[model samples]
Target chain A: MNKLRETLREAIVEAGVKDGMTISFHHHLRNGDYVLNMVLEEIAALGIHDLTVNASSIFDVHEPIIEHLKNKVVTGLEVNYMGGKVGRAITEGIMEKPVIFRSHGGRAGDMENGSSKVDVAFIAAPCADDMGNLSGKYGPSACGSMGYAFSDAMYADKVVAVTDHLEAYPLADVSIPEGYVDMVVCVDKIGEASRIVSGTTRITKDPVGLRIAYLAAQVVKHSGYLKDGFSFQTGAGGASLAVAKYVEEMMEKEHIQGSFCMGGITGYLVSMMKKGLFKTILDVQCFDMEAIESIRDNANHQEISATRYASPQAKSCAVDSLDVVILGATQVDLDFNVNVHTDSQGYIMGGSGGHCDTAAGSKLSIVVAPLIRARLPLIVDEVLCKSTPGETVDVIVTQRGIAVNPKRTELKELLVKAGLPVKEIKELKEIAEAITGVPQQVKPEGRVVAKVLYRDGVEIDTIKSVK
Target chain B: MKIVKNAVAGTLESSDIFIRVEPSEQLEIDIESVVKDQYYKAIYQAVDEVLKEFQVANGKFSINDRGALDCVIRARMETAVKRGGEC
Candidate 1:
């Protein structure tokens, strides 16, 4: 039986689109995604309101949701990461309800546990068959990995596959099997493939950022985690990419072969795997075009689901095997509480994508950031929003100095004895203040605008509306 | 001191504040900042201090702060106010 639908509106009606329902979308296409906006525009035109969108992440391209918010066509939002445009509006208290932010793994777990149920999941597939088998690796809009959509396809009451490329039934390869999909809709374009991997994947050239990266690599080398079979993860930030570069050099110099490098896999990590630095790349998501090509061709570059990446409820996830994870922060507190949820002025600009999960599961969670950004201290008395708890964090690396969490005293000693600049977290704060001048305490006056949830589905912090 | 002419100081760069002062019937201060939530009060306080020092009570002061420190904010406000009226 053919599952193909002629248009998105027909698929929406088939999926039973209505007001006040929790619908979901995956962000495997990232900033290039058009399905969410397209579907929402249709739903709004259908006069639907009070719909809660549980997207895997929200990007700058989804700014049309601002007008939807004003019209009360969409009222609730739940996401793992948020780009700056919608984030600024949310910070301004556009919605009466606070946005719910979950980690990548946390979102998967919640879906599996039925805590965050989806009435319908609209998946943007790169290629699919009439009978609904889908793959993200073989079409014009290919984004390489459909990892984030697996749970949505499996758990949602209705699963609609929107694709630009329609293959014949009984496809050769399938990322999502036909059994899980209910409907397939062929669209002119699913997304812009070029914009899927944005420009944030390059290595840093800023001297201060490079210095921090270098020091972070030194800490990883000296902390005894750089031995054989080490598994590592890092963000797609410029400085984090630079850390990978330095670490790759160190691994080659010492001839240490690692087990795996995981997370949003980048070309830098792909090169490391190619050079025999790591035996495999456990990529939950591909961050760049090089990574996409590598995963398409390389045997060792494997795609993993979000649950397999960092689910706390999973029997055992890849993050548990991680030796080190380098993350960036908007603001870090004296206690090492990392705030990736909001900026220095309490504006919603980011969220706990994998920050909490990796930090919680990795043997050493290292945060690297400049001491000051825009003349505002990076290290503060208290983070405006606690995205990752301090206890899970092991070290804080800045251009000026490094601070190991008091709980990681052994790691601290190891770095200090190895001639690294190891100092107290408070001291780092003082140094930052000395450079930027102690900033006045930011007072956010309105109601809470967002809730930062840990990997275990607990609310760690609430972000107040920017006054 | 009565305000003489509209004047502006500083540049719209990080760690700097651009302040402009002009004649007004009553004291008025407006501020826009990158770190607005955290430093707006402090920036307004700095401008008030500078205005009080100059004894200028009836001029409009507008500031665009790009995370400037209190000292830089004060300096820019002082300069702007000085150029606005008799030093």
Candidate 2:
């Protein structure tokens, strides 16, 4: 008995997609994703309306969704991150209901707890068999880890495998087994391979960014967390990437071996693992092609499910084992509340993917951002939206100074004792204000545009509409 | 105050606005922006505040905005108005 379908329409019919039902998609393909749009277009053509789309993330490539939202084809959106194009519309109060913004861990947990019930999950497999055995590590559109799709496949009532490349039966290296998937359909092209790793994944060459990175690495080294068996995670931002580089150098200089490096894995982390800096890489997603290739070939590079990666409901997740995690912030308030959800102008551009989860789970959560961006201060009295609560945040590193959370008194003392330029968070705010001047607060107008959820599924903050 | 010659301020950066002011019979503001669809009113409000502060009665102000914050927009308009009034 074959589970393969001739067309996506047939698979959609077989998956029992109906109006007002929730459908899901993962962003492993990132901006290169075609499955979400393809599936939605088909659904729209079939006269389906009021469908809620539960995607892991939405990128600029998914701008076609603006029309879908306008047409009432997709009335609700639940996501971890959103790019500015679609996000701008949401901020303009385009949808009737506010979008549900969840953290990566929160999304996985919500799916498992039945809070976010996905009726059908469309899995964009890079490689799959007739029986729906899938892997994102092969084929022309290989995207590396299928981590975010794991929960959807497991929890969704119907799972459909949409693939560009279909192999023979009983395919090896299965990321998701055949039992979970209900139907498999071959497509012409799932996504553009080049677009999968589009942004700058390299270390920053800018002096100011590098200085922040250098100081961040120093803070980590002296913070008492950088010993043998240390585990680390860093974002794909320029400064964060540079921090990873400097940390690797320090590890090599000290000859200290670490346990693991996790999060959206990059080639730099792969290089560190190769150089014996870390024993393994717990990769939930691959940031670049090198990481994709590494995960494909290297045994130390292990792909993990979203649940095992950072789900709060999980008994033991990789984030809980993390010693240090370097993250980026659009703005950080004096209380340490981070605003990754919106820009200083209250426009929705980003959201907490795993920002809150890793911060809460890790021993040291360091937020790295420049003091000023485009003539505006990065530190403010209050964040525009609280994407990650201040209590979970441990330290903030800026180009001008480093601010340790007051709760971490020992860490403050350690950094101060190490002769590091550790300053109070208020001082950092002052320094930023001095440079950019005390700007008028941007008051968002209109109704609520989105709800930012904490990793535990609590409504932490609400992003108001930008008028 | 009235504009005499064309004057421009600010760079066309991601978070900046470039304002071009020239002499006109009436206050005419033409804004071409990436964020004009969602933020035209806010941008107009920022321009109006700057114009009212400087008391510029009539000028053809062309704004090319790139998602600049209100403060930056005000500063840029202030600089351009000052320069435009000088000539």
**Tens digits of lDDT, candidate 2, A300-416:** 899999999999888888899999999989999889999998987898998899999999999999999888776568888889899999999999998898999999999999999
Looking at model 1 chain A, which ten-residue stretch has the lowest summed lDDT?
A: A434-443
Please give, for residues B1-87, the per-residue lDDT of candidate 1 as tens digits: 777789999999887888888898898888889886656677778788888888888888788998888788888887887788874
Report the lDDT of model 2 for residue A334.
87
Counting clashing residue pairs in each candidate, in order, gives 0, 0
lDDT of 1 at A460: 85
lDDT by residue (A42-73, candidate 1, tens digit) is: 99988989999999999999999999988988
Which residue pairs come into collision in candidate 1? none
Q: What TM-score should be assigned to candidate 1?
A: 0.91
Which portions of model 2 miss their true places by more than 4 Å? Answer: B1-10, B14-87
